[model samples]
Structure formats: structure tokens, C-alpha cells
Target: MIGRLNHVAIVVPDLEEGARVYRSTLGAKVSEAVDLPDHGVTTVFVELPNTKIELLHPHGEGSPIAKFLESNPSGGMHHVCYEVDDIIAARDKLESDGMRVLGDGEPKIGAHGKPVLFLHPKDFMGTLVELEQV
Candidate 1:
């Protein structure tokens, strides 16, 4: 069961600039930086009243953000993350329904160390879907 919209990830060329915009300009309280080495991403958080936004950039070649930036250096919206109660079950259903999983298989830890899995955009009308176990 998906709980709610957890966060929207936006790839950026500069993490500091992104933070300044989302924090000072938007009045969002920024959180600590989160490094997901496995995914090759360095993420920073912006806490909001209702939800949060994650500013992302590639930390290495393995990052999806790297590929995203290569195609469009200006960066763009990466994906939307939804909170889920049971990621395993959700992944199973999506898999059985023929959703393409981005990673090899199984859920992996995300920015906040929560179990996360991504559904290929081809399965969601070009919108990448991410499920995070809350």
C-alpha cells in the first residue's frame, strides 16, 4: 500500500545553487546531505509543510543522474517517490504486472536509508515511479 507522495527528485547541475533556490527563495528548511553511494547520487533535502523535495546530482558515473545530465545538462525532474507500507509486496505486484524494474532486483536503500525500488518510466507513461518503504 502506497502511503503518500514522499518527495519529488530534481536533478541539478549544481547542488549548492539548487539548495539556495529551494531553501532561501522557497523558504524550505534544508536537511542534511544524503549520499547514496550505491546509486552514485548525492542528495540534499528540503523539508516543506506538506511534503519534501530532494535535490539530486550525480556523484559518479553509475548515477542515473549522470545519464540524465548527459542527455540534458540543465537537468530536470528525475522521479517521484511514494511512501509504501510494504515495498516487497508492491514490487511483486508491479513485476507480475510487467513493470520494468530499474535496478537488478529487490529493494535497495535510498537517500534516507529507506528500502526503495524504481519502476521504469515505460511502465508509467514516461514518469519514473519510485516506491520507498516507510
Candidate 2:
């Protein structure tokens, strides 16, 4: 079902500052912020040797990240994405095992433009897990 670790998403109050920290301080390669209206987030990716770190900021009032920021204020780890060879098959197996999938229980186009599904945090030791099809 789960394959490899893809990327770790971090919610940031300021996308530019976050990317700057990763770029200047950590000396990482950061991408320009991209607004994803559908996902309701403006994101910047910090490319790495193995995986990536996604810095996300709320893009709109209705964004889920907006609600997250309200409580967190400083923002924090949003979710960890893992790759799956076959997302549909993995979803079915997880569902049969009683794991709850978020967002209509269907895969959506994620930040990577790949089919992705989020599983309930409670089901995965209090961590929101994203399954992305490879």
C-alpha cells in the first residue's frame, strides 16, 4: 500500500519567509510560490536530494489552512505525504481495514499534480497521512 516517503508539508503564516529560511539559512533550493486556488494554498517547494519539503500558506478565506492557522497561529506541520504504486488499490485495502479517508473518500489532484488521498489522523497515530499515486 504505502510506498516511499514523498514530502512533508508545513503550514506557514508567511510563505516567503518560510522559503527564505529554507533557502538562505538551510541553503536549500526553493521554488517560487505557486497559488493553487483549487487546493486553496500558495505553496513553495524546497527541493532536496531524496524528497521535498512543501511550505504552504492559506490562499483564500475558505482554505482549510486558514482554519489551521487560526488555531496554530504560528503554523506547523500540515501533513506527510507517502507515495503509493496504486492509490485506488491502497484506498480500497485501507477502507476495508476500517480506515477513514478524507474529502469525499476520493483521490484529488494534489500539490504534485498527482492523485492523492488523505486518511484520518486518528487512524495513523495522530498524524495526517497523504497517499499519492506514483
Candidate 1: misplaced stretches above 4 Å? Answer: none
lDDT of each: 0.87, 0.92
Write model 1 residue lDDT over 6-27, tens digit each, in one string. Answer: 9999999989998988888988
Worst 10 residues of 1 by lDDT: 60-69
Q: Model 2: runs farther than 4 Å from truth?
A: none
Q: Give lDDT: candidate 2, residue 73.
A: 89
Prediction 2 TM-score vs. true: 0.96
Question: How many clashes in candidate 2?
Answer: 0
- Would you list the clashing residue pairs of candidate 1? none
* TM-score result, candidate 1: 0.90
Score residue 63 of candidate 2 by CA lDDT.
Answer: 94
TM-score of each: 0.90, 0.96
Superposed Cα deviation of residue 113, candidate 1 (Å): 1.3
